[model samples]
Target: MFVPCHQKLVSAFLLLYCLHLSAFDFLWPCPQKCICRQDTLEVNCSSKHLTVVPEGLHISARRLNLSGNRLKTLIRRQFYGLTQLEELDLSGNIISMIEVEAFQGLKYLRILKIKNNRLKIIPVGVFSGLSSLLSLDISKNEILVFLDYTFQEMVNLRELNAGENDLVFISQRAFVGLQSLQELNVDHSNLTSIPTDAFSQLQSLSKLRLRRLNINVLPNYAFRRLHQLRTLQILQWPSLETLNSNSLVNLNITSLVISNCNLSAIPYASLRHLTHLIYLDLSYNPITSIESNKLGELLRLQEFHLVGGKLLRIEPGAFRCLAHFKLLNVSSNRLTTLEESAFHAVGNLQILRLDRNPLTCDCRLLWVMRRRFRLNFDGRQPTCSAHERGRRREFRDFSEAEFSKVFICRQAGILERKLQDVMVDEGTNVQFECKVDGYPQPSITWLSPQQTPFSSVGRIRVHANGTLEVRYAQVQDTGTYLCIASNAAGNDNISASLHVRSSSRNYTPPNFFDESLVETSLPPSTNSSAQLSSPFPFDAKTIVIATTMGFLSFLSSVVICFVFMFLWSQSKGQIKHTATIDFVPRSSMGGGGEGGDTGRFTMKLI
Candidate 1:
């Protein structure tokens, strides 16, 4: 191939220009002020004093965070070439408007968050080519109303959050094409009434939250077409006064919450078709009473919360039909009594809250008090004045003697106790105590491993306070000791092992029982009124035992030392030690408790 000299020069210059451009793009994929993560393909331009979207970004970038900037408007092709972007966060920007086809080629985007921006109107076709979009959060913006096809291009969208916007009226077809949407949040808005066909296209919607809206009434059959809906929450709607009959008919929801509404009674007819409902929360309402069979058709209901209502009474069989009911909260109410049959058929009840009610003390709550020991009804049981005594006291604190006239009560069984293992050296003492609390004043007795009664011997004693003490312990005292507390209700026992080890090298103790001691050496009387003025107030028997144990321990130590010295003396000179010095203090001789003495202590070793 032959080429002219001038043509070759032109081709070489063009190749050099292309190479320089490639080098520039490789060295700085993002703006100097922004931070780029090459490994994760993420670009963070947040708070970078940027006024416009950076022109060039890594082609493989997946997440782009452009929040906290002064970008005012998003023109067409602002994000021209980033095709692999899956998450784009443009929140906390001053973007007031967006041109149509602004995000033209972001076909793989799944999550787009433009919240906390100044966007007032979503121009049609703004998000045109976001085919794989799943979640779009445009909350906390100045958007007033939804125009037709505003979000029509995002067909794959699943979650839409338009909360905290001034959405006054939603056109009938505003959210028409969002067939895959499952959750819709329009809370904290100024929506007065929801059109009957507002949600006509949302067949797959499962969760709908309409909190802090000023809507007046929920129209009839408002949610009849949403067969897959599982949750509907309308919270903090102070203006929600009337709910028409059959408004919520033919629904299969599992949970429904209508909190802080001003309804005086439950709209039972409206909820008759929710047969599959499991949780219903009507908290902060003014519902006065709960009638029998009002919600009987909801057989699978598990938790029903009527907290902070003005409930006066719960009629018989109020919760009889809920076979699988687990929790019932009626706290902060004005109920006086619960009919005996209110919870007749609710066998699966696990938690029942009835605190903060102005209940009157009477025999109506006798069953509740008895069942308290079985159920986990640990919420505050009300305090009321005793009918006979006219004094206020807690429900559990009322004694069986006080309530004997009301009903025949049985004794309480053993609930809980603690027994610890005893470990000590031989010749040292050990004390084992057992505490028991039950009705009819349980009788406590200690026994050995052979199930025989513990004998009160010279080195063993059972105090009246349920304490067993063993003095001058031996290796034979290592065995299981059982404490049996018996009453009319039942008998419960706990056993603990005592381990007594020898004070010698490589000496592991064996577990044994010592029942050979005589049964005549009982302890002294335990008077309750004895007071001492000094710190070291030791009794005569305790002092004698302590001194004898101490002297024996010292003598054993000295004998061991003498044996070692005698062994060493065989290899060297004999080592002998002697000491003799004695001087009696004048105070000990009863000389006005003062002493001035001098003595010379002598020691001789050979």
Candidate 2:
């Protein structure tokens, strides 16, 4: 406890020096439960459970955050002395009323966020002195209508977000003075139609989002005045059904998204004028097919997405002349097959997303299989449906050597063993069966000896079962008929000869008359060479060979049937029954399937 006088004096001097330096640091007062950074002139008073704005804020504060608080009202000249304030955040508050002159002195403020508030109506002069504001967010509010000249004072405003509000009516002059506005968002509103008159004033707007509106149709020239718009998104309009032919006539947009709508088909006519479009997304629509030549006008389109739709087929030449196309995502669709011709014009495709589709593994998809490694699947590889082997498998599971085996295709083959030549009397009904089979199910067409194509019309008709029926056989119908079956794999043809004899002549059937019987039935004067030609021209040796082959085929069929029955009976006898009980978790029970059963007794034979 005893100290020398020299040591005590030195300690006292050091203590006073430290106190002097701390005095200058405490010149600016920071309110309780608030953080004030003097170096950056920023103050954060967020989520402090404060009832009123803190007093004695730093004069040089350039940024202030009062979000997530209980502040209900902003009085006149609330922040009068904070002249250097550039950014102010008052979001996530219970602010329902703001005086007209509350922000009258914030001339330097550039960004103001008052979103997620209970503001019912924004009076005309509420934002009177925020002339230098560049961005304003009033989203997630209960604001009803935007009266005329409501935002006229924000002349230099560049971006405005008024989404997720109860906005129903907007005056024509609501956006009269926002000349420098570049982006606007009015999503999730109750408006029934596009506010064309109000949008015409935003000539400088480049990006616009109008999602989740109650509109049902997009009328012609809906966005004609938005000449400078480069990106437009109209998503989640469930009632939207029709897009008029001239809806997008004057738009020069490069990116467009119209997803999650009730669009039954692509609005090809409406998109015909968007020649400058580069990215297009029509995802989550009920579009069943993409017809040929409909989207060819979009030559500059590079990325296209039609995900989660009812798309069944992409016809040949559907994407013709899209040389600049790169990315295509048609995932989560009901597509059975995608032919090579569908992407013949899209040679430059780099990223393909064909996953989540029931694609049939066939020759039509051979082109995709060959380039599987070179193309980017975007993390979701394509999967083949159960059409081939009753199980789904990803395309990457197959190797180059399995290409021909997995993606198999057969050329059309006639089911009949041989084409039957027929001789029918005139006026009798004549029919020719040309049943054929092939991968992708070939289409049948008939051609007469005169080179005339026959269809399901007039006296000659091609039935749905691939049978060509001629109601009344005439002399013109006599001759060889060609039945052609064609598909993507290949084409096959079979010919049948038909002879129609006149009804005036009486003749014995060739098959019924034996060689000896024909000679006796004919007159003695008629020469043997002149007798009707025998329909059956088989010799004794030929008859024996045919009979032996028929017997062998029948015997082989019987043996195979017996073997199948023996195996089935043996397997059935070996099965043993075991009583098992399974208890499914509540999480699994929510699925409402057999596997999700709460409690089940599985009786398996052991």
Candidate 3:
């Protein structure tokens, strides 16, 4: 049994040695100055004080780490045997010139990282033989620009990272045959401008990170045929104070981040045409204001984050058309107030973030604070600095429970409001009183059903007696209308509905008691077949009814006729139109623009 076990152990040793030889071909009789370790599948011939790589590298080796070496140039005969190599690391080397056909036989090479090299210009067709290259990291090199076809035939290349290089001008069609490219990072390069039609054929490019390039202007149609681009980060251009509107006309992107630059204002009108954007980040800019209804055209936008921009004030209704949003972050600004109806389209909002901003504790902030739910904040120093008695103090120190403590100082009381549940027909005048409890007389403003605020006018008037009156109310005004009553102390708001009563659209004169009768009824003794001939009869039983109906009709006719005659007579006469003008004295109107207290009045009608 011992002899048989010895034989089995010998057989196992032989099988393992053959497997090791197949993995590292440079073993036993290793290459001149290279030491191939079969156990680790690693060749550490790097920085061996050699000027050139000896021949006969492992054909089955998967990786060769040649960093920290003194190889100034590459010849084809050195790497002519590495057929199964997938990863080649030549980092921290002095590779100055890469001869043509240097990598001719490495068809299955996937990764090539040549950081901290000394190549000034890469020749064409240098990497054309790497058909299976996936990722290439050539950072920290002195490459200024490469030939147009330096990386021509890399069909399966996915990511190319050439950041931290000295690239000033790139040749058009530099990255032509890289069809499988996904990510390209060339940030902090010295590129000034991208030539038009530079990226005309990269149909599969996904992410292009060219942030912090010395790019002053991106020429029109610079990114023309990049239809499948998903993410674009163009930021940190301090000299870029403005963008010509035609720079990015039609880009099919999902996330567009432009921040940390010196842009005074984003031309929202230019971006109103991008119909496929979903996430937009325009923070860290110097934009001061956005016009109302800006960003109203981005129909599919869901996440809008604009923070760290030195914005003084956003005009009310600035984010007019950005509805159906999921997350909106507008914090870290210099804003003092948020009007009560700040979040206009808050019906579908889920997350509203407002942190690290100088929010004045006033009635204006009460509107947004009353609705902020699950608001995320900085927990370490999460305190809202507010002005209090004689000085500024920290209030609401980032606690969920404390945020519920509304800090209203000397505001109005809970002014009671109620609505009458009475039904009225259409075209009838309706009136209601707006009552409130305050030290100052309450001034009221009404808003129509369609979210339009009302003004005191001829048709819809508000009397000094605090009564809201509307004449000839139409069916379109059949919805809940808001009434906001406010004075110096605070404000109180409520809504009232005016419903028009029309015969229900479904109301059919059901089969009358006599279905065969052509007319409704007649003032007779159970007569079903006889039609109401003249709608009235001067009979004994119907005399009183006929006389009453005649009186009402005559009265209505007299009122209509009187109104028409009065209007006609007034039209025919020399009607003198009165104009009320109380001109302010020159001395009294010295400083004020409108109010001079000289019984000031002016009238003009359209």
Model 2 Cα lDDT, one tens digit per residue, 91-209: 99999998887898899999999999999999888898999999999999999999999999899999999999999988899999999999999989999988888998899999999
Which digits, one per residue and each the tens of the lDDT, describe model 3 over residues 1-606? 357888999999999998977754534346766777766666667777667775666666777878887888887645878888888988887988888778888888889988899988888868858888899998888899866766789889999998888988777878878888888777777888864555666778888777777666556666788878888888777666666676667688888888887777866855776788899988888877666776778888888777888766666676667766677676787765445343447666666556676655544555445555444333322234554431243334333444334334444433556664445665667886776665334567777767776667666777765567877565665777677777545788877778867655433343435767676444447554454554654555578788899999999999999999989978897754556787656654467555554666657543
Writing each residue's lDDT as its tens digit, candidate 1 over 1-606 gives 999999999999999989977875686487777888776788899988788898778878899999998989998978878888999999999899899999998989999999999887787788889878999999999888888777777788999999999888787878777989999999898888875577867889999988898877888888768888899999999988788888888778999999998888888888888899999999999999888888888988999999998998788788877788888889889986665578745456777787787755555666666666555665666655434452466667776676656422234333445657888888777888777776435668889767778756656777776778887778888999888877544677877789988776543333345546535355566754563444567877889999999999999999999999878888797545887777655565567433467556777865
Backbone clash numbers for all candidates listed: 1, 4, 0
TM-score against native, each model: 0.60, 0.72, 0.60
- Structure candidate 3, residue pairs in collision: none
Q: Which scores better on TM-score, 1 or 2?
A: 2
Best by lDDT: 2
Which regions of candidate 1 are displaced past 4 Å?
A: 1-28, 378-606
**Model 2 CA lDDT for position 521:** 42
lDDT of 2: 0.88
The numbered model that scores best in TM-score is: 2
